[model samples]
Structures are given as structure tokens and as C-alpha cells.
Target: MNCEKIKESVSIRTVLESFNLLPAKENRKTAFYFALDREEKIPSLSVDFVKNKAFDFGTGKSYDVISIVQQINKCSVSDALKYLHKFDLSVLEKESVAEIDYSKNYEIIQVGNVRHPALVQYLKSRKVFEQRHLVKELVYRFNGRKFFGIGFLNDSGGYEIRNKYTKICLGQKDVTWIKNGCNTNNEVIIFEGFFDYLTYRMIEKEENSIPDHLILNSTAMLFKVKDKLKVYHKISLFFDNDHNGRDTKKMIQDDHDNVEDCSLLYIDFKDLNEWFCNFIEKL
Candidate 1:
């Protein structure tokens, strides 16, 4: 199989698990596995299922299925392809489709004003305690499991649920907009996540400088907020200091003449919340 066929037909998780390599940390679509070379306490090898690629965060090296096989078997390129030739492509395709489980049903048990102390501490942990009034506390369940988290309501009535370790959503996917930022404001500060918006509120508590706010929640929904964004005359983005964030910032800036990327303000950090917490810690 060619590289493209191997990537499309073979499941990365199936391949990794077949080798008996355990992941140290795992989320819905991403995981951190111990590097194939050494046994380090910190797992620096990151594998992204969505992207169908793996990166050794410790060594800054990237891996595809071919390289992954080559690494585990200590084989050359031809040998890796030769090894893959034995696998059944039909079964691999079925395994890959089963990897993404989005059929989860989350029932909202309660949604009201924020009062939960754990949720409050969660906001504080992200250094966004002052913006608690703008968010709500939600009690939700999935697969008969009960959980509580800080919720930011999106336009579609879905709540963006966040806690110390969890970041998820219920109902629908969309953006969060706060228009009354000092009434009749013509500008809006955009963020990729709600924590960044709260961090902006914490940093700029001044009465006059508070403009509007927009939290995209997910970078995938960045385009969904484009229509509402055009309503504002000026736009400033505080997207994360990553490739996806930068690309989204550029896409918006290229389309709108009055757009500015404010990421330089927190150039060293990944996002506004990270920068705010680090700054507060230093103080």
C-alpha cells in the first residue's frame, strides 16, 4: 500500500495497540504516549487521531504510519511497507470508523446561576474568577454519569462545559457573544475559548476600554461566527499561539480590513488565560 492508502485504510490506534504501546494520557481525540525509544516519566509523544499524525513533542519529530512501524520494528522503508502489505485493509477501515464515538447523549439536569464552589475554584485556577457572573453552573449527565461544570451558553442553547480536567459541550456547537461591552461599542475582541475572554475581562477591568467579546469555543466553528463578526466595525483577535489559531487569525484579517491580531500581547504564552495566570503568579 502507498502512504495515502496506508493512512486511509489503517487505524493508528489499532496499530499502536497491536504493538502493546500504552498511552500515558488520553482525551477524546488525542493522546500522549511514551516515546518508542526510551522509558521517560513524562510522555512526550503526542498522537492526533483527527490529523492522522503523531509528533514526538520531546524531540520535535513527526511520524506517520510508515515511520511508526519503522520505529517499532527497527525496519527500513521497504520493510515497513512490506510488513503493512499483510494487514487486511477492509477490517482496518471498519476499526477507524469506530474510533470516533460522538453518539453520546448528555442530559442537562440543571442550569442556573453560578454557585458551585468547585466550579468557582475551577475558574480561579484558570485565573478568570472575576468573570463568574457572566457564566452559569450546569449539572449534566452522559451514559448515566453525573457531572457539574462551569457553563458558557452558546447561541444554539448548548453550554460549553469546563472543569479542572474536562472541556466539552452539550446540545450544539457555536460561538458566545457579549455585545453590551459598554453599550454601542463598534469593536469586539475575539477569543478561541471562553477562558481567554474571561482573562481579557480580568486584565482590562477598566470601565472605558471594555469593548464587545466573542468566544469561538472551537476553532472548527470559527467560520460559523463570521457573519456576526462583520457587524462589528473593528475586530481584535486573541487566538492561541498555534498554527490553527494563527491561520484562523489570518483568515479573518484577510477578509476584514479593520481586523488586528492581538496575540503579540501574549506572544510567549499559548493563549490569554495562560499569560494571565503566569503574570499573576509572577506578581
Candidate 2:
């Protein structure tokens, strides 16, 4: 079979399971299985059922069904496909929409209100302490070690975890949607990160007029939220003044009407949060 046929025939979960690499944990949407070769106290491999792909966040290695078979079995292309041919994959065509979870390799040791002194200080240093209600203090363990960070919940049930030293996502990396009591879909605003959204909450003088918000968290996720974007009568973008952000702005403009690229307000700055912080410095 061709690559496309092969891809359609094999599932990511199947490849991992076929190797007898059982998941250490599983959330509703994702299976936290161990890597192909490496043994660990915690599983570092994340399997996305919705996307049919796997990522070893610990090693920064991504895998597909075929690649996974090759990795686990150490076999050639023909051999891998032959092994994958045992099961009829026709059922996957009508697969259920599973939840996307990212807690595969990490265990939450503690999750509390955003009250950790260091995390609070981190927010203050970024000029977003006032918007602390929008985040959490998440303490999780990975590889037998504990780590904590400021965490924001996205629409995908995963956390956009961040701190001074760590920026990795803690679950299925996805967008965060906020409908702040706007009855009609009159207007909508988009942000690349929660920091920008929180910064806007901190800086925007007009409170009641604030439209709904969508935080992509990562630019690669922009495609997933496009359908949601079409519902708004007016769409405003607050992306960074960088290549990925700028490119995404153009892409959105091509598909949506009444769209505004508001990044020009801080054209010289990197992002909305940067502009807010720098403006505060000047004041």
C-alpha cells in the first residue's frame, strides 16, 4: 500500500500497544504510554487520538504509526507495513471523537489557586498579577522529579503550562476560548497566548465593551479554531510582531470578514504583553 493508504490503515495507539508498551496513565482523551525503547518511571510519550500522532515530549521526538512501528520493532518499511496489516483498520474511519489529554508522562502533585509566592512573583514581574484569577498554581512530577508552573486551562482540557524556565504544554496543546458574557457574537478578539489576554484585561480601559476572546496558545493551532472564528461579526487579532504571528494574521484575513489586525498598535513591540509591560515601564 501507498503511504496514504498505510497511514489510513494504522493507528498511533495500535502501534504503541502492539509493542507491549502499556500506558502508565490515561486521561479521557490521550494515552500516556512509555517511549519505544527507553524505560522510565514516568511515561514521556503522548498519544493524541484525535490527531492520530504521538509525541515524546521528553525527547522532542514526534512519531506516526509507521515511524512508531519502525522505532519499536526496528524493522524496514515493508516489515513494518506487514506487521501493521494484521488488523483491519476500517473501523478507525468512524472513530469516536476522543478527548485530547496531555498528562501522559507527568503527574499532578499539587494544583492550587495561583498563590505560590514564586509563581505570583512571576506574574507580577510580567505585569499580570492582577489577572491571576485566570491561571493556576500547578505542581506536577516528571521522571521522578517535581516541577511546578503557572497553568492556564485551554478548551482542549489541557494546560498551557509556563514559568520562568519551562514553557512546555502539559496536555493536548490547543487553544483557549473565553466568552466573557457577550450575549451576541458581535465581536471577537484573538490572542496568541494567555499572557496577552491577561495583559489586555490589565490594560484595557473599557471593561464592559470587551469582546469574547480566543487564545491560540500556539500558532500551529490556528487551523483548529478557524471555524469558531467565522461566527463573529468582527474579529480582531493581537498576535506578536513576528514571522509566525504575522503570517497567521494574513491567513486569518484571507478566510474571515470584518477582520482587524490590531498588532499595529504595538507594531514596534513583540506582542501585546510586551507592549503592555513596556508601556508600564514608561509610566
Candidate 3:
């Protein structure tokens, strides 16, 4: 297909998903995706499904299907057009146009302490049962069915709900920042998720030595706490040992002078929690 025809036929979502990129936050008409060009804490790529186009708020650039492919793949116009040809336009169009009813997606049933046997076991399996107080038992309903998970509350009052079988969010997605009492600490420790933060607490023997904690809930939330992080004299990162984690760690380092990458401590494992679980298994 020609470039113009391809742009009109294929949705930007299809092109983005082809690169394994998903929306960070989305509504029916518009979705925010992580920027293609750089590592960031907040998603700045705004996609308009109706227009089949995207705008990078970070870079102040605009893209259609063809240009987006070119930007992500760094390919020529000819190659981008060839890549676009692989998509079945009819199916993509259907998916792109469908409206999601966010109001009915999920309902919060209860928020209480961690008492469920299954949830307790789940936490134990991760070697973080002692840190259970940091999270809550979230009972929610979705699609006419009831479900429950270990819920970590974020700054925006959303819950990072996790179970052995499921991982999801209920409400607005944001970071969870736990300040030391009276903001007395000059140092801060950053974690990519609540589990990792709990793992750090589990391994650290000295309770008083632990610094202020910021559970990003997602690396995408790093942007939300950038200014907050600047106040600390030392910033230690406990991100996962993966591409996204490493990228975010580097971004933090670039932005701050006293940054430390603590993932090297568990370099062989996927994350701090995984390393802790393996350590417990060995014991």
C-alpha cells in the first residue's frame, strides 16, 4: 500500500503494539503511551484513535502511522510502508474504534488488612509476609465476578492489585511515596514496584537505617517524583534487572548527581523480590 493509503488504513495503536508498546493510561478516544525516543517516567505520547495520529508532548512532534513506524523502527519511508502492509487493516480498524466503558470496568468491594489465606500465602511465597502491613487486602468486582488481591495504595488513591494469577490496577495509576517521619532523612530509596520496596525492607536488618521510600508502582511514574527526588542528598534505585529498569535507572542518574544503581546487588535475578525468594529457598 502507498504511504497515504497505509496511514489512512492502519491505526497508530496497531503500529505501537507491533513494537510491544502499550498505553500507560487511556480512555476511549485518547491514550497516552511512553515516548518512543527516550526513557521517561510519565507517558507523553498522546494517541488520538479517531484521527489515527499521535503527538509526542515531550518532543513536540507529530506522527501518523507511517511516521510513527519510521520513528520507532528508524527505517526509510519504503521500509515503513512495507512494514505497514503486514497488518490486517480491517481488524485493526475495528479494535481502534471500539470504545471502552471505564466506569464499569471494575468496582472496589472492600479495602482491609491482609487476612486472606491465599493472599497471605502469596506474600509468604515472595518472602515478604512480614512486610504485609505495607499493603492491604483489596476485594474488587470485575465483569460480574468477585476477585481479591494484595493491594498497594499509590499517591492518587489507586491500588496496585496483585495476586498469583492476576496483576491489575483499580483507580487512577500513580506513584506511592512514603516519607520518613517529619521528612527528616536526606536520603531516599526508589523502587520500581511495591514488591521490590517490600523486599528491600525485608532484607535490611536495621529499621532505623532505612531511608525514605518511593514505590514508583511503575517506572512510568518516575517522572511524577522527579522534583521530589531532587531534595535528597542520595538516591538509591532498586529497579528490576531488565531493559526498562536499567533505562529508568540511567534516566534518574542523568537527572541527579547522587544517584546509585542498586540493581547490581541482585544482577542475576529479575528483581529484588525474586532474589529474596531465591535466597529464602536456599535457606
Candidate 1 stretches greater than 4 Å from native:
1-104, 181-185, 205-210
Model 3 agreement with the true structure over 1-283: per-residue lDDT tens digits:
5677778777677678667677899876899999989999999999998999999998899999888888888999999887876564653334224263322478999999998766775797788999998899988876665667899988888888886645566778899888866445588888999899888888787654557888988888877888878789999889999999989998989999988888888999999999989888888
Error of 3 at 24 (Å): 44
Angstrom error of the Cα, residue 211, model 2: value is 1.5
- TM per model? 0.61, 0.62, 0.62
Of models 2 and 3, which has the larger lDDT? 3
Top candidate on lDDT is: 3
Candidate 3 or 1, higher TM-score: 3
**Per-residue lDDT value at 138 in model 1:** 90
Query: Please, what's the RMSD in Å of model 2?
Result: 15.3
lDDT at position 275, candidate 2: 84
Q: Show where candidate 3 strays beyond 4 Å.
A: 1-104, 182-185, 207-210
- Give the worst 10-residue stretch by lDDT in candidate 2: 91-100
Give the C-alpha miss distance for residue 119 in model 2, angstroms.
1.1
Residue 88, candidate 1: how far off, in angstroms?
A: 35
